[model samples]
Target: MRILASLQVRLPPSRLFAPTCPTRLKSFKPLFTSPNSDLPLDGDDDPDMTDPVKLAFARAEAYKRQKLQAQSQKLEASLSGNGGSNAALENPSSSANQGSRASQVSAPKGKPPEAEIIVGDPTKFENIRRRGEEPEKDDGETEAYRPKVKTWGVFPRPMNISKTYGGGKVIRPGDILETKEDKEAKEQRSRELVTAYKSKMGLDVDPKLIAECQKSLKDGNELMDRGRLNQALPFFEKVMKDMVFESELHGRAALQWSICLDSLQRSSEAKVMYKKLQNHPNPDVNTKARHFTFSFEAMEFMKVKSSYLSRTTGYEMYFDSFVDNKEAYTSAKTETKEAGETQILPYVVFLVSPLFVILLIAVRKSFML
Candidate 1:
């Protein structure tokens, strides 16, 4: 029973756990002998007993060591100026259990993870948006409500306005104009154009004849331009009669004479001229006739008498009556004034003559008595 008591036994301790093994201690090394041979058995020794007070002291020491380690770490972080424990320091009353809240609260202290504000390229963004997106809202205006643009049409209303041309001169129909400086200058130019035409015809033309033809042609051209082809006909005929040979001038004169004759309502004369021109050697006669065919036709149409001739005759008679009435009124006014004077004369003569007779009779009576 004594040997049994010498066996190694492990005891539970109220103290802190120790890293040293009690059974492996050097002082307990000789206890490995058998207990029946008067030696302690390896299992017969009792392990060290742990006291509650020692366990409490060890726990206190451990807490102190942990606190020093934490302080050192905090001191290192603070030396680096890294805002160590700033969240807890700034808001000490905040709950430590809420880690997400702590991180959020601590975010402002540290350099916020390089918030690179990336502003996209304006041109690139504009191109992308313009390609696909609808345009920005307009300020409440529809395209149809916009003012219409006015445009001039092909056949706009004819303007009755008279505008000045060739300086400030006012132009009118049938105004005889001489653009030349003097009568000499006019005659000189006329002689030149006539002489040039005569030379082209290979005819020995007289200067006086050329001058007369030139004058006729000039007057005819002016009258024709004013649409007085009836008045222009005699002048053009005289020019054609003076031309000895059928030339370009002869062709022009024939064509113009035909036109003037048509305007004068001399259709028989005009058709004769046209027949002669149709067989003329010069091509200009045919060309001029072709181009002016419509003009010649229009002149013929103008010759047709309108049905309003009787109405116009009545208006003329009414105008004559109005003139006669004015003359009759003047005669009646003279007669009325003469009659008034005659009536006044008779009254005056009767008043004076009776007085004169009474005075004469009275005088005679007085003498006789």
Candidate 2:
């Protein structure tokens, strides 16, 4: 009250926002009054100077009363006379105002406009820096121009994957990636198969025959080492010419015979013996047969034989491996030579020129001495 008295003219929200037509509102009565409104605001003379809260309550009550009156009037018109058209005719301005308010309340908001895109000619580059500029009309090149296809990179979907050997092993198609367990199982199965085959053969060598074969093999090897191939021939033939194919002695004798035949320039016979030794029971004999040292004539025969065989066949890959390594080494050397050219700086020529002059002077001094 003291602050209001000091100001001499008190300011409140109700007076600033008072309705324009007070005379019409003054005659109206509100149905719902605020129970908390004990602010002496219902006074006839000081309506503009009322508390802001009281004024808000009064306005809300007035609005509710007006809505109720309008709805009741609409209902009365429908019951007594024509209908909605008559009600619209009776309150055209109010109906228009209500429509405008409804439209304002339910109005859709706007968004920024989308970017405009213009396609260009199919034959031309669309992203050229300068507009209307084009490439040359044609060149003498006969090759057709092909552009890389535009494609989206689709991420591979997650899969519930499993492997034969389990995780941490990188496998590719046709790779023989055997794990320890698989290898062991394979070895066991192979042993079983070999035992079964041997049992099926059912034939046994006599003790005397085995002893004689061993003695003959030793004598043949000793004769061969002494360069007496003709003398070794009879002993090796004695072991190889019999039904001792399953014995290690027979394989050894066959290998020695092939060697002797190759040394004697009997290449055709040597190749047959070597090929026969490939299926020997002894692993060492089979390996030696496949990878034996041969004379020039034998090697020539092998070349002819390999030409008839497929590149993936036995010993063909071994032949190609040496050629492949040579080619690779040659290519690497060529690349290194091309890349390692000595680069001499122009300034280093000055140092070299002085050294050459000193060298010439030293030579002249030596000649003078």
Candidate 3:
């Protein structure tokens, strides 16, 4: 009976303990729970925690507190006398007062508070008027003074009419005007120049075809100017197809097309096209071609200049051969050095040879004696 009683004492009162502990935990849970019980305490888990409006309000409150602290510090500093502190104190105090005013202003019924304005003190401007009664001092130097020369007199400057629209010899009242014959001769000369240019460019195609080509070229140029190289390529290609080879227009078309290709990173094709222009009849075309080609070549040279071997071979093959050759050369050099070091000394050879010869001669003389 005692054993049974002891066992019962030693064992916990499970019913009572479980019920009481759980009751206590349940009671404390509400106290430890977050204010919004539906949302988690961790900021990342709560969707509304990062709301922009709430963040903005927090920032504004923080800024306001900082501004109030700064204003107080500025007021304190102003009470202390320091040489450069006067300007600094006035500026900060005015700014602080403006900040306080901004903070005190009420917002509209449904809107957030307006941003604060911190005004700096107005800049002090000193009056710096020169006295008219002051005597002017003249240094005895005349080199600094240069007299201005008149570029135009009674007649206006002559203008090159061909180079600019609305440019010609300026006429005053009663000036002799160009006669009809002179006008006709000038027009005839312009027509001949146009004809010659057309012949040079092989632009003697049908008017409709020429117009279409010109339009295409114009579109291509516009696209190129706007940095749309890919879009320009088709128009340029169309014009190039219609242009006769070696003609001035064809050379221009090809050059422009190659430039577009180069800009687009189609380097190999651009290089090939540029090479074709090397034989161009026009000196300008040939010069331009050489310039672009050399530029590309220079870029390529810089790219490969650091490499020990040419880039023509595969990396695997080149690297393997280089490593093998290097290793073989190093090993051969080491072996040769070791062999030279182990070689018999010239002094030892000279001493041994003389001693053996003397011994042989002494033995022969002793036998004869």
Clashes of each: 7, 0, 0
Instruction: Estimate, for each residue in 1-369, the C-alpha lDDT of model 2 and write its tens digit.
Output: 888778766577555445322223443432335664322233334554445565566667667666655655564454456586677687676566566554554455697655645587745854343445564443534233322343552432223224322666678999888778989998999999987776443245666877788898899999999999999999999987654576777788888898898777676787887778778778999888877634334657767533233446577777887787464435788777765654445557867899999999999999999
* Cα lDDT, model 1, residue 226: 98
* Superposed Cα deviation of residue 162, candidate 1 (Å): 78
The residue-by-residue lDDT of candidate 3 on 251-332, one tens digit each, is 7778889999877667789899899999898789889999988887887878843213454766688677767746443578
The lDDT of model 1 is 0.61
TM-score of 1: 0.25
Clashing pairs in 2: none
Candidate 1 structure quality by residue, lDDT tens digits, 1-369: 999899989887743244222222232211123453322223334445234464456445544555444444444454457775683485343334445643554456756664434377766664343443574543544332222234444332323222222344666998756554776797999999988876767366777887778888888889999998878878887878877546555677778888777666676677666766765667878766665554556657889432123436556877787787464445888999999998899889988998999999999999999
TM-score-sorted candidate list, best first: 3, 2, 1
| Alpha-carbon runs more than 4 Å astray in model 3 | 1-203, 304-369
Off by over 4 Å in 2: 1-203, 293-298, 301-369
Which candidate has the top score in lDDT?
Answer: 2
Better of 1 and 2 by lDDT: 2
